[model samples]
Target: MHAMKLSAAILALLLPLGGCKLVPTDKPDAETAAAQTDEARMAAYADENWSTKVLPVIAEHTVDYDTLQKALSAGVETAGNSYGLRPEGEANPWNFVVSGAGTVTEAKLDSRAARMEVDMNGDGKPDVTLQIGPIIRGTALRDAMPFIVFTDFRDQIEFAKLARAMNEKAHAGLDIPEGDVIGKTVSFTGVYTMRSVDDAPEIVPTVIEVDP
Candidate 1:
């Protein structure tokens, strides 16, 4: 009877400790859950709207290189208000949707993040740098659209992933030719970001048509 009572007392003592665990089951908080999902959400946003919305906005807002140069000569903010896009209340660098036809003066195609120097004017000087990428850099495309807002994202990290996803989309959509395009003429419409009016623009092309 005493042994039975002792066993029952031990069983009662162990019952309260059943919920206690030596290892914690780490549960993600709301912000962490949102952060995990934000990349795919942004990628889906890029995929669904890239062709229908993003491209049309770019086409509508496009300022030719000559026109952009003239506007930038006035001032960076002046040019941004007239022909570029920056998120309201954010210090996002002004991004421009621009178009130009140029002859390739130099092709740096050895790297995955390759670029070309193009002579836009007949002056024979390379005027702009154009990215030809299996790897595209920068968030110029994402920044060029006023519809994409910073506050819409969970955090800066999540917001930056949108840029990465957008770049991947741009690279996948382009039909980059296989050889060095040094002497070829190419017409392009793309996005670029400028911190200063004097900054040499490196374009991330949405469309690049190389002449045969």
Candidate 2:
């Protein structure tokens, strides 16, 4: 009878200890929970703003090289030193200058840099120039209007691969050459921002002249 009583006491002690462990652990602090919720909400808002507000603006004001020069000439100012090309046939008419033939000497999934030799004023000698920037940075002006939210998560990765692939096809199906667009003239326009190359940096357009 005594032994039975001792066993019962031990069982009662263990039961309470087990219950203590199993009790609901403290939940995440209220502040942490609220912060997490806020972060998620902000991300969603940014995505929505990009699709609805930002993209439309970029479409409406697609810029070409000629247009850019005009805007620059006119002294139209912008923050970030960003400039937009006025639409063709607008009140302030702009002209695109086709000086010479341009070729895509290098192409990548995200970025394409090319060189052109053109006679800006019909000179016989070819003047060499370069065009470099993101591959896809604009939408059709008619479809969405002008929206200027530069986000290229994929292009950044592709750009990292551009230098090595300059002479070879970096993408599986796309053919890129070191000196391919040797005799063709291409037209494109985009915002030029300065970047550093070989420790030298300059402001150049993010969009290079491709097709009109």
User: Highest TM-score: which candidate?
Assistant: 1
- The sequence of per-residue lDDT tens digits that candidate 2 reaches over residues 1-212 is 99999999999888977656555676677655555543353344345554466334444444544444444553433311344333333343221221222443333323454333333323444422333322322222111212222243135433333222321211122222334453344443322221111211111222334432
TM of each candidate vs. truth: 0.79, 0.33
> Which parts of model 1 have CA positions greater than 4 angstroms off?
1-39
Question: RMSD in angstroms, all models?
Answer: 5.3, 11.9
lDDT of 1 by residue, 130-203 (tens): 88786777889898887888898768998998998898788788888768688899899999999997788989
Instruction: Tell me the number of clashing residue pairs for each predicted model.
Output: 0, 22
lDDT of each: 0.86, 0.34
TM-score of 1: 0.79
Off-target runs (Cα >4 Å) in candidate 2 are: 1-10, 16-55, 76-179, 194-212
User: What's model 1's lDDT at 177?
Assistant: 72
Q: Give me the overall lDDT of model 1.
A: 0.86
Whole-structure CA lDDT of model 2: 0.34
